[model samples]
Target: MKVLIVEDEKPAARRLHRMLEQLELPVEHTVHSVKEAVEHLSNNTPPDLIFLDIQLSDGLSFEIFDHVKVDSAIIFTTAYDEYALKAFKLNSIDYLLKPIDVKELEVAVNQFKASFRESGNPIHNKAQFQPIDLQQIAKLLNEPQNAYKNRFTVKVGEHIKLFATDEIQLFYSENKGTYINLPNGRNYLLDLNLEAVEARLNPKTFFRVSRQAIVHINAITDIISYTNSRLKVKINSFTTFDLVVSRERVKDFRRWIEG
Candidate 1:
């Protein structure tokens, strides 16, 4: 299969490429931004399948469709909330949430093969696939009232403990494991990764200061200037680690904190 991947993060693109390689499906082309993807699609033959990310470095990947007509099948790889991705499900499109699972990736690829490959040529067959409504999806994403998690449950030996969003100071990932830091300096291990936690928490209340940590707005006691143009966040009680805002996210972080 001629596969193309359009993802902004190079590490994420590499990880997806490796996963595809493990499934014996080699990626023929990988582009980082919307501009690169549009240029490649305009010049070369459309790929049989495209692993597309919703957000790109330059702009939304939906912009690519505006620039060129694509007949290839697409499977979205996104960090968007489940509600935001519901449009894809309704449109009969498959999507893998961030920190893609290997088994799910295999299933999506197998399903694509069954649906498209079984019918002969996978490209230039508009009838076989539902036309993706990019405008409708963009509209769905812009809608307000997205449901966000207000509480989390964690196992404490023989029982489970429920912690409200207000009780948590921060969520961080370390040594390949995710943990929730509480106001009393207690830390509980979370089953989900940092990305999954970030997706569930309300963005208004929780801001991902860095890939390693997401801090509750009310929990932040101070913001200090840091090296490399990054900002360091101080949580009310969780001082186990330094919560530094990534350089790229500093501008957005400042705006979010101000509100």
Candidate 2:
């Protein structure tokens, strides 16, 4: 299968190229920076698959998607752990944590071949490929080494107000936008998406109970057992929707609350 490698480090890129060569997969091209990668994809036909690195020289490789539409499937090779889980949720073949292992690369390649064989036409199934959410990636990568956002600024009509993170009870998404609720019964729209906002907040103080809500530890006044072995969380503020811990996140939610 035709493949392209977009990696910034020369030795790493060359090593990956050699690995693919050993496997006898046709390596179409190898580009270093996001700019060159974008330029190549703009002029040439997209490869069947791309072995992409998350952080490139100019910017994160996700920027290439912003410039052009790519039909190729992707296997992200990166040293960063934060975005690896999120990257797999996209139409990615696999995420290979770096200092690439030969066996892991082989397995990822086999997975791709299996999917490609099943799909019959890789290019036609491009609709399933979701572009990497760069905003969320940026938030994750820029997480504070020793600090989190202590306060946030929100615009209210004609004025901007600042609220300490401790003052906020919960952050939730509704009508495609994120909003934060306060103890004083005030709600303000936030500029960042729920995922981005969650990444910035201190995980110890806040827990993402569901895709729709990130609740502060102080906000949860009650946790009632709910249907399907899920949990119904009651916050200080009255919410129109039931704040339920999603089934998948239930275990972690329990650990967070108990701790």
* Candidate 2 residue 148 C-alpha distance from true site, Å: 14
Q: What clash count does candidate 1 reach? A: 0
- Candidate 2: how many backbone clashes? 0
> Stretches of candidate 1 above 4 Å error?
115-117, 123-131, 147-214, 221-233, 236-259
What overall lDDT goes with each candidate model?
Answer: 0.80, 0.77
RMSD for each model, in Å, please? 6.6, 17.6
Task: TM-score for candidate 1, please give it.
Answer: 0.66
Write one digit per residue (lDDT tens) for candidate 2, span 112-224.
Answer: 78878888555333466554455676565555652366677665654667788898999998886678998877788764557657756898889998889999998889999
Model 2 residue 98 CA deviation (Å) reads 0.5
Residues 1-259 of candidate 1: C-alpha lDDT, one tens digit per residue: 7999998767668878998999888999999889999999999998999998886767778888788888888888876666787998888667887657677899988877787766866633445443667789978765665546666766566456778877888999888778899888899876455765776678888899888998889888888999999999887777677889999999999999889
Clash counts per candidate, in order, are: 0, 0
| Residue pairs with clashing backbones, model 1 | none
